[model samples]
Target: MKIEVTHPEPKPGEPVGAQYWRSLDEYADRPEFKEWMHREFPQGASELDGVNRRHFLKIMAASFAVAGVGLTGCRRPESYILPFSKQPEGSIPGLPVYFSSSMPDGWDNLPLVVETHQHRPTHLEGNPLYQPYGSGLTAQASASVLDLYDPDRMTSSYRGTRRITSAQVRDLLQETADKFAPTRGQGLRFW
Candidate 1:
């Protein structure tokens, strides 16, 4: 069935982003509005109409699917626990560990270090040996340690598949470098 829609034009001198709506009684009395409302949403004596049932079923199915996903995610997986094979020399089991490092954000580079405890980065401090900002840490530099240890960073690295070992990656890189050495101007150079 063909549906017709009618909207009143804005009057002159009316402000922008302003809308005009007629009263329910006036809208019901208008033939064009009545036809439009009937075509868009058909009212029934009871709630068990075909169109209403289809819409209700679609909503219920979506809600059930979301609930099922939530329920499945509620159980913790065994692989979430990661224990270190060997702890570092200066690292304590539950204490924070700090290391000096240089971080460049945009054109400016800052020399700072952070203290991380139990996999969560807790605090940040400026490097004493740095020239310009010696032993003084900014708020942004301090907060950057939290960003480094964010859960989103872990999720991005380990989203779909298991991680590969660094040794396996280094061996693959060495093999590829050997194969491409000839093409990289070692003996294949024109001049």
Candidate 2:
């Protein structure tokens, strides 16, 4: 049931000044507000409709039964943490390996020194040896290494909603190139 509350109005000759009021009901001293404040909770706050003790017990019993079955069924997947039989040629177990590389931009490349731990690229820095583009990397180049390990990075090409293999993609590109070969890609649009 919706409770109707009315605002208190000032008398005609009463002085109306800036007053700090917490709530309209408290400021107006309404009977409904007084009744609500006297109770620990608002009406029906602690009530559950149509959920008796028997129904609640049945739900709890079913939940426990399902949980017991799940717990019994679950076993840790078989896995072995084996050390490498032969260490990589130039790798030391604890030492990070650095490789000089370049990040391709449109018409230019950003020289980079990539640091890897266990063959995974962990960090990237400017290639100090490259004289022309000094030992300084752009922000994009610095953070580009993250893309290598990104879990959501696309690993396969897709045509609409269907996944297509690399070989199929290559063949399709070749066929398109052959189709545009006579015109020398005159009608081709990159976008």
Worst 10 residues of 2 by lDDT: 40-49
- Taking all chains together, each candidate's TM-score versus the true structure is 0.36, 0.44
Model 1 error, position 120 (Å): 4.0
Error of 1 at 161 (Å): 17
* 110-187 per-residue lDDT for model 2 (tens digits): 888999998999999989999987888888878888898799999899999899999999999999999999999999
Predicted candidate 1 versus true structure: per-residue lDDT over 31-72, tens digit per residue: 876765666655554456456777988999999999998996
Alpha-carbon RMSD of each model? 14.9, 12.4
lDDT (C-alpha) at residue 149 in model 1: 58
Which candidate number would show the highest TM-score if scored against the true structure?
A: 2
Q: What is the TM-score (0 to 1) of candidate 1?
A: 0.36
